[model samples]
Target: MTLNRRQFIGTTATMAAVLSAPMVRAQGKPRVVVVGGGAGGATAARYIAKGSKGAIDVTLIEPTRKYYTCFFSNLYLGGFKEIEDIGHTYGGLAAGGVNVVHDWAVGVDRDAKTVALAGGGSLPYDKLILSPGIDFVEGAVEGWGLSAQNAMPHAYKAGSQSELLKAQLVAMPAGGTFAMVAPPNPYRCPPGPYERVSMVAHFLKQNNPTAKIIVADPKPKFSKMALFQEGWANHYEGMIDWIGDDFGGGTVSVDPNEMTISIDGEVTKVDVCNVIPAMKAGRIAEIAGVTDGNWAPVNAADMSTKADADVYVLGDASSQGDMPKSGFSANSQAKVCANAVRGALTGSKVFPAKFSNTCWSLIAPDDGVKVGATYEATPEKIAKVDGFISQTGESSDLRKATYEESEGWYTGITTDMLG
Candidate 1:
């Protein structure tokens, strides 16, 4: 049976819609499967399950039993937090009626509307949400790969990586060198690498005072650039050297075996090297065939994928415009997506999608800076409406207040995401 391309596409679209309908499932309740239990996935699953009142079946799949948040992980290096401070579990979601599955989502069969697990089964769903966060771009850093991570830890994913990097930092010889190969733009947490630099500097000042910290940044300017520079000058003074693109910081390579880094043509031996490479959406997004090579394009209104309406992508994995890929942004987008998904399945009252995000970075003790914005769903993307940032010359009291505010937000958000 020969069919025209248009006819075949149209026929498949109709079949997909019919197969994705809620009534087709044997459970009789519409099923939503969420992958990657981070800020976005956890919040969305919790919201949907809590809001639907058992009218919808919600499931969350995550490979890790204890999820470690990348946000605030820098504090652990600076001796401000313990690893347990950022770790969370899925018990709250399970208690909230969400079917929490501790397994990896290996494949997504959109036509069959089922998610394949790494364990051994497939779970059917009417809708699927992916918020798998950032994975490093392959070969983004020369002479570096996952195999070399033990020597030059990225620590970008938190957990063991963070611990490894901290151990290396602590073991640096007196007056030794510490170098960071910062990632390029459009990566997760714009200010994250810089914050890590600040935290590292704070640690060196207290423990290994003459030890130098150097940053090789691909971008000429970074998030809160002026503020970070101001804080660095005030606190760490001659302890840090920042080499941006103008100084050949963009061209970098690392030799993990020799504990050396080459910036432009200058090879220098360092005691510890933190290499953060360019990033892409998590592997699952690409596996689902919804990514535009690097990230999954999502509609701002509901965080649904442009490729398939039944599939949604969130957080660092989603290419939604005007929002920096941060935990706050993910949590904001998740609520909007959860409301829309619940409304779609249960005919509940859906609010207009309004989103907001605030990212806070601690420069030193009681010295914190922040940037934030509110966003609205435009037809094209999630467009920024208004924004704010902490000033460079802010008073110490104001800075302390800002730091305290961030602490409060951390406590609030963790509970919000987990419970």
Candidate 2:
């Protein structure tokens, strides 16, 4: 199973032949296979494919033909944005000489160094990057499952469910109640659930003033808590209610058919519900035996899995300390992982890695909140060296500017991923 010099050279030649028609193909370079063409995987693919100037054959295996970012998903739910605005295509990656395979990865044969695709094929890689994102703990809420999603939408992943939740909100009666069950700490996008509450309240205030939003949170505090509370009070007075872990508001079970959630042994019914369950690393990461508890463990030096040297995990799937599981973090980690993979394949020196992340959430159309951090790897782990949070009571003008900056970041990052 060892790749001899002749065999390695022959494989490179075959790759070159296969990519001859593509003007941007990297000839005589090691073949790299990346799974999950989301923020992290796509960014890694683009950087390694383009940065190497055709010195690496990059193939991205992703099931979806298009990607929808979770960042601005609330805007869509609040009727401020179209779903199409969040959707992006893979054509840019293809144009950049990346072989974009539209297929789900069922498994990875670590011993064989091959990725098993759902389409009855396998692709080998000199190095692999995986960033499949998060999967919900299905049975975490009693009586809740896929079948129940129609009545109680968990718009955590931000696609069809987001629209479904929004539609329900729109259809609700003027004095109806909207209940949100927020998960415990260490979930993807910590500020997300609260932000969702704000957005929903904003819509209700303008369109249906009598409508109310009750947030049942399993945690005592959440990301940007003070800021969110301030925004809610200042904009939509008495429209939002929060139930922390101490209150009877933390959810334990759900009856989707009844639109009722049980918290602190009391059942409360709502006209509409958004139940975001506890999350874990995506199913593929668990199947690959790379997860520690709920997330994958990686060496901060290069995002390589502690379980497997050949496999690198990034994005919301990895247990990146002091770094939120935000899209920005995933994108930054992708570049670092790409450089490490390139070095491993070509026997080049590994570069010093630095990672950054910023997550912005909107309260009103022009009112935004943000938190960011920067990290650098030490011999032990990735350590946060610098960070900042949006100042409380910042003027609407500043908040609006930050929102615009978020849009610019989306465009820039997407370009970096596919261009």
The sequence of per-residue lDDT tens digits that candidate 2 reaches over residues 11-90 is 99867655553323254557788888888999999988877778788999989887887878888887778999888899
Worst 10 residues of 1 by lDDT: 18-27
Model 2 clashing residue pairs (backbone): 26-54
Tell how far residue 277 is off in model 1, in angstroms: 0.4
lDDT for each candidate structure:
0.94, 0.85
Model 2 lDDT vs. the true structure?
Answer: 0.85
1-419 per-residue lDDT for model 1 (tens digits): 99999999999986776566444555588999999999999999999999988888999999999988999999999999999998998899999999999999999999999999999999999899999998999999999999999999999998999999999999999999999999998999999998999999999999999999989998999999999999999999999999999999999999999999999889999999999999999999999999997999999999999999999999999999999999999999999999999877766778999999999999999999999999999999999999999998999999999999999999999899989
Off by over 4 Å in 1: 1-27
TM-score of each: 0.94, 0.91
Tell how far residue 352 is off in model 1, in angstroms: 0.8
TM-score of 1: 0.94
Residue pairs in clash, model 1: none
